[model samples]
Target: NATAKAELGRATWKLLHTMASRYPVIPTQDERAAMKQWIFLLSRLYPCGECAEHFQQMLKEHPPQTSSRAALSDWSCSVHNIVNARLGKKEFDCRTLSDVYKCGC
Candidate 1:
């Protein structure tokens, strides 16, 4: 139902953002390609059909920034803000991203 979809979206975004927060500072070419591929695969495999469609379109428009950890994290926050705006949700404060998303893993 709607609650399940919303929960899925929350979990997905948390995972993505946390991954970005932990990404290599200066990723290797292969690492960069892997992150890009992972995002595309996620868009295709996401459970919610409508959300997946919107995510694919956003990916097409913004693409992923895998050059560095900071770049990837910033890109993630920006894209998430876009989605939040679309959903009438409050935008996250990107300045505190690093503090907010420590994986401790």
Candidate 2:
């Protein structure tokens, strides 16, 4: 169960970060609001209850940055780093995110 939870978390984070990477550089108000709402919904609906609670708290403490694709991507990386730190995982170099998460979508 724990291994399945971990795998789900990894897949979710990858999907989120890749989406951020492909977001519009200059998003419309509707687009920005939709993105924020999507994250909120994801946090609420995450499969793991404890992880969902933690992510909701993180959202309150460090809200999503949806001004631009780059900003959102950076925000995603920073939040992932927070989760990684809590799990005793090695911190990723956020500066390399532009090169790291391009999905070519």
Candidate 3:
């Protein structure tokens, strides 16, 4: 039981980490405000409809930070969401998400 739980945790962490890494650090208010478009892109990573289509266009126009701490949390959150779907685990707590994505925030 402990081993299974540990593997699950590791897998979950990896997924969230990968996703979060897609964001940027935007150190200024202007930079932060400018991210509205990208933030929207992140929120609709899947379910390839107009939202996804639009997001893809934006990504091509301006690729993500790729290694930003600020982005890690967001990417991680998305990955976490997918992992939950696969594992049938409940979503991580908001506090947990906040902490995992501290660098991104």
Best by TM-score: 1
How would you encode candidate 2's per-residue C-alpha lDDT over 1-105 as one tens digit per residue? 899999999899999999998999999999999999999999999989999999999999999999999889999999999999999999999889878787976
For candidate 3, the per-residue lDDT at 79 reads 47
Where does the lowest 10-residue lDDT sum fall in candidate 1?
96-105
- Candidate 3 lDDT, 1-105, residue by residue in tens: 667655756754565464454444534555544554555555475443543564455555555443445554554455445547656988765446645533343
Off by over 4 Å in 2: none
Clash pairs detected, candidate 2: none
Q: TM per model?
A: 0.97, 0.96, 0.35
Per-residue C-alpha lDDT of model 1 across residues 79-102, encoded as one tens digit per residue: 999999999999899999988898
Mark the regions of model 1 whose C-alpha exceeds 4 Å error after superposition.
none
| lDDT values for all models | 0.95, 0.94, 0.52
As for candidate 1, its clashing pairs are none
Clashes of each: 0, 0, 10
RMSD of 2: 0.8
- Give model 2's TM-score versus the native structure: 0.96
